[model samples]
Target: MKLIDLNRDGEIGANCHYIQIGSLNLVIDSGLHPKKAGRRAAPDFGPIRGVHLDLIIITHCHLDHIGSLPVLLREHPEAPVVMSTSSRMLVERMLHNSANVMVRQKEEANIPEYPLFTHEEIDRIAKRLTGIPFGQAKRIQGGKDDITIILHPAGHVAGAAGVEIHHKRRQIFLTGDVLFEDQRTLPGAKFPAGRFDTLVMETTRGITARGSEKTRLIEVNRLIDSINDTIQRGGSYLIPVFALGRQQEILSIIHDARKFRRLVDCPIFAAGLGMDLADYFDEISRKTKHVRFNRGIIKELQIKPTPRKLNPGEDPQQNGLYIISSGMMVERTPSYTLASGLVGHARNTIGFVGYCDPDTPGGELLASKPGDQFLFKACNVKTKIKARVERFDLSGHADREELLEFAVQADPRVIVLTHGENEARAWFAGQLAEKLPKTKLIDPVPLQTYQV
Candidate 1:
């Protein structure tokens, strides 16, 4: 088998990998980089431009894993796209929102190629999608070199999966952005048991030494206390979250907290694509029962929607909770806009619930000390950091130790690590070297192919 890394940047953006086994050619994901724009956001498709891919499998609906899908479909219209049923329901809306974001960027960022793919194009691409149930093995190619694929729940988000491929006599496993522990909305991963000849995994949280030590219950209680403290001080709280998994998870936590009287009754507001995605989550939970979330939680909590644009000099703080998207607080996003107005207020608090790229606005705010002056580039506004800034370890990815333990248990002969920065991959590699001294570990070189 031959494997190639297609991500232009070595980090966690534009996550695409190509694998050629016997007569089958497959691409694991086609994602766009959240930190970059236009062509730069997409994975490098130059090497596989004319390659006839038999299949493209998307493990989840996150933008980083499915954003550049239209580009790939445009090139290889014949290749069938496979994902979980829940992912199919979410990807349609996610891609449409992505197109809208790109269109806005055209006017805001001066990118001529903004809206890389139109809604119409996405509609066309959707026709090629084939949703499959978890644990069901489906054959794609026939004859002696037949290839079959099975998807197992990966637990990062609704419909997220780890794929197992069987070709001829060999088996390969790909652990797409995975989380082993359960969240409020979803159960923990149900990875297929046993070993494989090759294992491809993610190392998104390997850089942190003690990331896995903190349990979800502990973090949730801490967040509850923080929110309670902020509200008790007559201040509003802001949680900048990703529209998909984190939003729903946070909402569920807050909803339960209020139900148990752990949190004071306050107006809860959510804006951006996350609100829309939550609706889909409710639908999926009711339909499939795959998610443990109550469908009526949003309505029960009476969560309000923030207006598209706040009025000039408007005070968003009514001593309530505001949940907004662009998890990294990308410039011009709802979170950034709301934060600009809230940061200077001494009584408010802004809590980060997930991973933030060090270069994004969210990371800057988190790294800033209280009373520091910070500039928000999108609005060209400067504000003092009077509001409390805190980050909770609510990461969706499995912690470094958890992931290492899983890898060790799987015991694959050859292990390939992807979807992490250099430091993170190095950390995993060092640990693996000590834990499994004889096992072969491969850190892929971008645009290079390796035979395994």
Candidate 2:
């Protein structure tokens, strides 16, 4: 079996890899890297064009992982896009939302069009999606000679999974994105109770430090308390959050804090797609009860006004709590505009809930000199430095220590690391090398094929 690299970079519009093995072709996550000028750099799929894809598995609903599903399905309409039932539902929502974001980006950037496939193509691909339950193995073909596959929970997102392929003599485990230990949103990935010939896993946070979930919750609550104190001094809280995991997790935590009276009442403003995405978490909370919903329950939270669509010069209510998308203020999404409008306001606090790439505006704020105040260009409000900026350690990906433990548990003959920048992947590889010297570790370059 050979593995092909399809978009090795962390960002979409970058390079991508596609794999072909025997009569079966499997395409993992396909995405592009964003160009320097904000255009998407499409990956080359010429190598796998003629090959028939027996199955396609999506790791999670993240745009970088599922962005090119439409592109792939548009070309190979006969191939079934296989993923978890929950992922199937989530991706359908995510992909459609992605199309809307792309359209908005084009209009905002004044670009005539984005080269990515249209909404129609996304719908076509969505129609071909086949949902598989966890632990159930499906045969790709009718005969014994065909590929056999199993889906296991990766514990990254609600329905994220790892794909295990049993083909003749070899057992290959492809961990899409796993939460090794102490994950708050979902359970840590359970190692398959068997050995494997080759293992393909993503190293998104492989080189970083991750603390325990309990510790993180404590720290996050403390930070929220400090911010709330400032808010009591007439400051508002601004959180730039993604519409997926982070938003839901933060909302739940804040709600819980409110329940225990650890946090005070400030209107919780969930803006843009966040308001809609919270529906999923609310459903999860109601169905599972595993999620904590104290006082600031999402279903009870108020919806903030869409300031962008409002009259050009209108300001959002400046007194309560608020959360918006584009967690890093880099994307021209609502969160960015909100940050620009609220920065320099002495009566507000901004808290970051997720990892912001160094180039993003949120990153800039986090890294900025402590004494420096952020400038705002939108609302033209230059208030005092009353907003407190802090970061919480509620990361979705597993860190270095967890990665080593997970690797040891899997105990594969060979390990291939994907879905990280070269530096982080290399660092993770070095750690893996030290922990499991006997196993062969591969750091794949884009489009490079590997045989196992």
What's model 2's overall lDDT? Answer: 0.67
The lDDT per prediction is 0.88, 0.67
Candidate 2 wrongly placed segments (more than 4 Å): 8-17, 32-41, 142-144, 181-185, 211-214, 281-296, 302-317, 373-386
> How much is the lDDT of residue 52 in candidate 2?
72
Identify the leading candidate in terms of TM-score. 1
lDDT of 2 at 33: 51
Q: Relative to the unseen true structure, what is the C-alpha lDDT of residue 140 in candidate 1, on a scale of 0 to 100?
A: 81
Give the TM-scores of the predictions, in the order they appear. Answer: 0.97, 0.88
Q: 233-348 in candidate 2: lDDT tens per residue?
A: 87667778877776776776676677777777776677666667656655545554423323246555554554455222223546777777877676456676666655555566
